[model samples]
Target: MAGTGTRLTLLLFSALGFWTLWGFPGKNNLLHFLGELSEPGASIPGPTYYPMKQKFTGIAPLDKQLTTLVGFFYTAVDGNRIDISLSFLNLGSQVLAAWILITTESYRAGNKGSFIITSTTLFGLSVVIVGYACVAPIWFALHLWTSKVVSNPRDWNIILEQPIKLAIAPVATLIGFGIPSAVMTLPAPSVISFDTKLNWSALQQGWPIWIYLAQKSLESIATWFQPMVSMRTEKQKRAEMVKYMRRAYLFALGTSAGAHLLYSGLGLAAYFLPGALSTKLQVQLQPENFFIPPNPFSDEKATTLPNGALWFLQWDLVIGVLATMIWGIAVRLSENGKQDDLGAWIKALVEYGVIAAAVGPSGAAVVAVWRRDERALKAKEE
Candidate 1:
């Protein structure tokens, strides 16, 4: 049964990853009739060539409005804005699904810390899925390593909260380390040639790259420490792990939610003051500025997408991290003498629905495993 579940998960990962990469933006296989790319920078002469530019009704009102709005600004930007937005959404969903699926598998295997390692590793690898499919190998490596080590219940509680920390660490590193390093190291002008005549500013334009590099470097350092920390005896682990997990969940949640608001706030401000704010906004949406990591094996960075896609990125990070944090807090709070049977079930079910809906099959599987674990807990108590 476990083997079957693992195989099914592999299939899910392959299918979703392919659909996400192929169906979104540049390689839009699904809507091939709308626009066809004969090759990079080459298009077939046809009636509906690059229909992203054409006026058309979307399936729903919001969709139609969004489509129209995106098309209005698509040509002004360096890259295909609409395609980039949609691609990032697809990419985010792909990562969410993979995270939920792998975490569920780790939970099912009775290795609590394994999910943390697997999810973080997958998060890092998702950035490079464009160049190479390293998901399977990373999964196996983390899985094998984590499986050998059994965590105490107290330690498991601490490990569960670290994923939220892991998620935020990169963003923190970017702001704290990447930006300062880049500012010091980048050339005086900090501008690079985008096109024959166009200049792209590094600090102003390469925010995404800075964030990616910061996160990748920080994640490697953090992940290396996880095993060492996990392996420590109770005396060695007690003080630090307790201090860390107590605040990790809340701190991570606050940062994620705060970042979302900040991004949206800037967008709204930019809309009203385009002349005043347009240059600042332009820095974020600089064309062909997409980040390609230095190496395939150790790092991952999301596609260099348009500014409009920041909303999707915000939603994915905020919601995903928020959900995990809330779950951790609820469980921690319930660590009293008696279990709140109804409350636990209700929370678990709600999470299942949300994850399944937002993330898809993998989420549903995660919730299902949680439900099983809950029932077993109750049975043991009875």
Candidate 2:
């Protein structure tokens, strides 16, 4: 928190938090809905909220908000503007890459400390209570400036990590994040019961905790069956570490690129082959629709359901990516490399553009981290 990087994070993302909040359609009569979460069904059902048109299910308010917002987005897209729905697919991909990257870093040796900073359970729980947009900047800043692994990259002792921990990271990610993401998106009344979907969506909000538990549980099992974990030779350990880290980078790269390409295709179809197959809305989908942030300074409020969704999501992705890029650049700058000249930076930026064009923002971050790991391992070998 004392470093210049930490201060910069606060200055930039704190404003973003406010901008996202500007989408809070005041007078939505949400106070009662929030209050009953602790003792839901304790009293008679009250007024129904917009979009859902049903009483709150007494779940965590964040889960309820996520389910309602996503449901509204799909319904709106189904009715019209299928192109806008495409944005969610792309953004969802980017968010996934960011999540995977952060989850991986949570296990770094230097990252271990206070439960909030290093502890996986506490970190995941915090993100559950506070949205990624709120938690990520602080987390990124802590790593860039304060964490021993990032700050003292060359110190071998700072590299403390269990092989089983690395191996289980991706598995936990799949079970904890991937499955829940898919389950919550199941179509209601047609594919699954709306109430069931709501229940699952609420559960998904605590994915950070789920991922932690999954990783620990898997690690414990691996320790029992593979008791020779600590007996591996140095060469064997190094090779295995490289393999797992490479797998992580590939997973991050593939998911982000896949999502970006999927949605990008959908957006293009809106213009190129309007009414292509069963798609709705033949209106043009502009780049601004995906890249631009809503006017946060306007006198008008985002009082409608669609506008509120757009306002919140647009800022969430835009700000989230920007914060991630800053942290990536900070790490890249700190890595051991030929960074002394202007030519190197221009080449690096060019390479980043090429990767980003194909895979999206999260891919760029993953590549930066991949390169950093390569440099660190190379240094160790030397």
Candidate 3:
């Protein structure tokens, strides 16, 4: 056996490998499925076959080339028009944009500290990709769940024997579990703004664009009210940034895992339910394999399930709102007299909500420092 450190490294690598290979259910295995297309007469599912190869063009030539190559490869593999797989095109464009911007920035910055820049860019991109991996599947699941395709009688099964109980039971159960989970994940004010008077350059260079934008918006709202939170020293700000980054990672893992768990449980239930589905409906619904269940060891023959991840996200969001309301009320209640710090909490909430709404709740908390500096400039002018 390898040493403890070696074993740990292997374990971590294995986990990451699994994630990269099968993270988002049907989504991640595109390459594997595409490989099957290399074989003669492999049948691809869902998309209708098209003889003409599809081409994808983007804002940049390189983007156009890359997407087109991808589109062509997809068409080759599936015998389907690339345009039919709009998700891949959209994802490719966004990823291409992010890479181009990051690479441009890195190149313009020069080789003096190229390693640091490269590392940061890679880490940032990884985070972005991971965020998308979790989000896209959940979104698709939700879209599928609500679509007219699922409106058929055989598509869904009632959990309880009694019709009325079955109708409301699952929803009630979702409400009971989902709301609290969502609330607990809500970004607190501490995670939002800390009063660092960071400039625009600092913000643009250090934080994600969504975080920077949300921070700017939140700062504007705060300026309309007045200063709310206590300022942090540069050292303290750096420390807080590191802390928030870690928190963001944890939040992403938790939310994604929770979402996958929900998918797996519901999927298994639908798959195992007796007499609730006809053979045609069972094949059509694919209740066992949806969202891929976070299992890395599963083979190509894994049972497919219907996408229902979005339903989980909706429940989580409901909890987030409830949690935010509770937090807001608690802040109000805790405010004692004329010197209350309610404004700080309110500003933080605004900042949190803006970021959470723009990105997911796993979004970063402290990117509004530049806006604090902006408010300072305006104050100077006044």
Candidate 4:
């Protein structure tokens, strides 16, 4: 059982790692190639395209020549590759943590059933989350909540509550899903600031802030539904369960906020520092900038705004780390009072963290493949 669990966990992490590398923004050389193809006469620019311009503009005053050199590297390497690589590293860390949790649970239960049950439950929840809630509007309330404007009466409360919950709910949602709601709505600026060019302010007087806050609120509600849908274990008392769940949700919110702050700080530094400083500072450095243009142009000249940097701050690095930690901590605590070997516990923590962080929109895909294989074998035997 231990061997099987370990193998399964490793396999999931491996698949997620591959997806992080290839499926994400940086490693996708094909996306650039395809974009160039789709828009003939338009060539894909590399990441240095912006820094080069900034260097020329005297915006990169310190180490101007170094900034050009850095930009040259970014243009050569695909930005998607950078995103994928960082995601893999972060996911790898998370997987290590999840392994710890699983091992601990196994030791405590004195059997593999608890481990299997927990895995299956998480798998099921991932399916609903990635498939129905994320991909499709199968849930009417969720669909209304995510829509640009809620037309349904049922969604009215969601719209109303979104403002109040913006700061808190996004943090909670990030904890549950590892994806911050803020990223989907916000315009990417360089890591240091958000692009206000097309922001709500451009549309009208108060539209941008209102829309941003509104979307955040909706995202929060959507996130809250995930745990409720995924939770399977029953509590001895319903009230106690509700109380505990609320507390857990709040804790996740706080942890996510802290993680966001950490990631944002790194991204901010990376986006703003002149070329020379990027070389000196490794923590804030992003490899994707080495290959892809900060903004590739097809029709209009690419805007000078720092969208890529903003996206990193809002979605990619910071949110990923927070989500991984939140889920890792939750899973670990769930095994409370379990007497498991330290190694096994460590292994479980690593496994779950990897699965959550690297998989992103594909967690359900992993679960489905596993289930299908199991069913096929079962049917053949029967």
Give the winner by TM-score: 2
Q: Write the per-residue lDDT of candidate 1 for residues 1-382, one digit (tens) a residue.
A: 1122333433454444343333332332222322322124422122213323222334455333333333322222233343233333333333333343343333232454455554544444353323112243334333423442212122333233234334444355346333443333222223422221111211212333444466567667776877564355654443443344334323333333343334334444545555665564554433223221112122233332223233223333333333332333223223331223556546655765565444332334334434433443444346
Alpha-carbon runs more than 4 Å astray in model 2: 1-11, 22-85, 114-116, 155-160, 268-279, 337-350
If scored against the real structure, what TM-score would every candidate get?
Answer: 0.37, 0.79, 0.30, 0.25
Sort order, lDDT high to low = 2, 1, 4, 3
Q: After superposing candidate 4, which stretches have Cα over 4 Å from the reference?
A: 1-28, 31-239, 271-382
lDDT against true structure, model 1: 0.36
List the lowest-lDDT window of 10 residues for candidate 1: 195-204
Regions more than 4 Å wrong, model 1: 1-17, 24-123, 130-233, 263-382
Q: Pick by lDDT: which candidate is best?
A: 2
> Which rank order by TM-score, best down to worst?
2, 1, 3, 4
- How many angstroms is residue 199 displaced in model 3 relative to the true structure, after the best TM-score fit? 33
Question: What TM-score should be assigned to candidate 2?
Answer: 0.79
Q: Give a tens-digit lDDT track for model 3, residues 67-151.
A: 3223222332231221222222222223222222222222221212435433433444343333333332322222123322112
Number of clashes recorded per candidate: 2, 0, 4, 55
Cα displacement (angstroms), candidate 1, residue 158, comes to 4.9
